[model samples]
Target chain A: MSPFVLDDRLERDSEFVTALGLCQLRLLKDSRWPWLMLVPQRAGKTEIFELTPLDQAMLTFEANLVAGALKQVTGAKKINVGALGNIVSQLHVHVVARHEGDPNWPGPIWGFGTAVPYDNDRKHAFLTALNEAIGS
Target chain B: MSPFVLDDRLERDSEFVTALGLCQLRLLKDSRWPWLMLVPQRAGKTEIFELTPLDQAMLTFEANLVAGALKQVTGAKKINVGALGNIVSQLHVHVVARHEGDPNWPGPIWGFGTAVPYDNDRKHAFLTALNEAIGS
Candidate 1:
């Protein structure tokens, strides 16, 4: 495990999934879509450039792993993966599965409509399947 | 070097800057912003999972290297990086340096405005500095 701390914004917003090599994968609380976030457990690292080359590589692996599983498990039409630090500024990679008619179909998902927080039972089932898919 | 080929869409749209591991870094001919695209030269590969683990790691290193250089050379306020395969599903990574009031502030830069292509002299100068910055 890394000597890193989770950002308060992420902790408060997301439900913890599991940890990968250099990232802690979290499920965004939004029930509108299947979205997973990989937060690198590197302290004070807001940008990808701030990470060591090795950590960067490991991050890529973990990002791909999570994205692949998310796509397969959800049967999404498309998968969008990005690391945008405009608002949170904490180095978090978002892996979102997109469908043809999802709320924000053709545009970037940031600053979109309100997030529908997941209910307890649904969140449990979804996370359980996701954990198995990601082999966590 | 791997036997990778550039996609036709990228070749027609972008100006070749240099080659990094797992990608060919190109300047998205738009002069309005300092935008660069890293297209993984792996032929016919559209997803990150298609890449070998080592190549994925190498791609991460290259993306960070280019992003770091771009941030320094442009003195940007923040850098936006993502692998959005919406239009062209050829697995290209975008590394854009964003300023506070650069046309689209506090938002994603995709499809914001018309792209103003760079002129020969300006492109040459910019790429020259970029080459040194990224150690190409």
Candidate 2:
């Protein structure tokens, strides 16, 4: 197994959630929507296609698992799964639980309204529920 | 081999480019940015996790291939890949090429501005060059 080192951008933008089997689940500090970013624990990897065939299957499985958990917790109207390496060139997947009437409804949630950092109580509650939902 | 039936939204929203062995490539008709959508031919699928292990690997391969082609042809500053089935339930992956000074710039492109439809000549040139770039 390759030792995974997270990029600085991801580190700065997110708070630690927990570790999954194949990826690190980080809570995006934005608190805009119930967003979770899954970065596969592979060093120097920046794209999904870089994974081996078996690893591709694993990442897809993990992404689905994480996204489903987020959707259930948030009752999201939709879930947006994206790997855009525009700012951060890390191979991380954003599994965002989209709610209706959100600040940027029916749009991609990147670089939208100022991200509100999660308050202490709200963050604790959300993380606890997320951990339960993800069965981690 | 399964015959691919395009979802109505895909048909209306994109123009066909070419096909890799595992997926079809289409340019997202929103002239807002150089974007491509990859849809695997498996009928009635609505999510990436729903794909078989083999199909998942194949889709990943094809998505990267198409993304690379788009990036080269457009000289995009970044590439955004996503599979969000919010409005349309069909399984489609978006590979968008982001420029530095695009209208949305650092923001997500969804719902930012009205998509400028590609005129005939422009669309034709883009399609032809994309096809060539992908070595189709």
Candidate 3:
């Protein structure tokens, strides 16, 4: 099998945080929401079913672990998880930490507005805490 | 433990299709997109991580099954899966079959536009075919 390649759009918009059992964890650049994405290291796969059963199970576990970690680190009221490949056609799961009155409250944050890239200090601190939270 | 109760908003917006091993499958009323929701029959749970490990694994299996069935029945170019309990904290997973150049191409369907309820005949036909595709 060919080595997995991150989608250009995802690469441009997010920073690598760590690697999970079956996915490469990345923190989205947007500062408006506490968001992390899990991209399974599988080439040419665009949907969850495209993964083998073992990989699928691992994806679930990793997603759960990341979501819980995100919630814990951010103290978010809710965590929104999604795998939408319409624009990028590469399988990546988004785990966003949402508060009651975040920028896009009670709504999915996929296409809300211009992404406010995180400043360097905030990004560093966020990634450090997240790494500690996920133990990665 | 209390019996599972469908959230009022979800109940108003979707029709019961069938019960999978771990979720109550329902078809969204919107005709714009072929959307199905898999709501785990576990009351008061608003997140996948809140579920037991076994239930979480079952959710992954059922979601894959429904997404595949929806894709087969709709011939959708892509299938988007999400579990966002922002508005209705019912812990339901959305399995939407998306096609290229559809109404909201490259954008999420959530909170995009008002839903157009499926007419009686079309709804019946869709439910029949979906049931057959899911082998329920």
Which of the numbered candidates is closest to the native, going by highest DockQ? 3
Which prediction has the highest lDDT against the true structure? 3
Considering just chain B, what TM-score does every model have?
0.91, 0.91, 0.96
Per-residue CA lDDT of candidate 1, range B1-136, in tens? Answer: 5566677887887878887767889999788789999988787676787788877878888889898999888998788898767667778888998888887777888767888978889888888888999988
Query: Over 4 Å off in model 1, which ranges?
Result: A1-3, B1-5
Report the number of the highest-TM-score candidate: 3
Q: What lDDT tens digits, residue by residue, belong to model 3 across residues B1-136?
A: 9999989999999989998999999989899999999999998899999999999999999999889889988899999999998999889999999999987788898988898988899888888998898898
Residue B34 error, candidate 3, Å: 0.6
Q: Would you list the C-alpha lDDT of every candidate in the order shown?
A: 0.83, 0.82, 0.92
Interface RMSD of 3: 0.6
Candidates in order, TM-scores: namely 0.90, 0.84, 0.97
Measured against the native two-chain assembly using Cα atoms, what DockQ does each of the candidate structures obtain, in the order listed?
0.64, 0.56, 0.92
Give the CAPRI class of candidate 3. Answer: high
Lowest lDDT 10-residue stretch of candidate 2 chain B:
B104-113
Collision pairs in model 3: none
Clashes of each: 0, 0, 0
Residue-level lDDT of model 2, residues A1-136, one tens digit each, is: 6678899989999978898878888988887788889998888776676777667778887888887787778877677899987778778999988777887677678877688888889989988998998898
Per residue, candidate 3 scores C-alpha lDDT tens digits across A1-136 of 7899898999999989988889999988899999999999999999999899999999999999999989999999999999998989889999999999898788789888999988899889988888898888
**Pairs that clash in candidate 1:** none
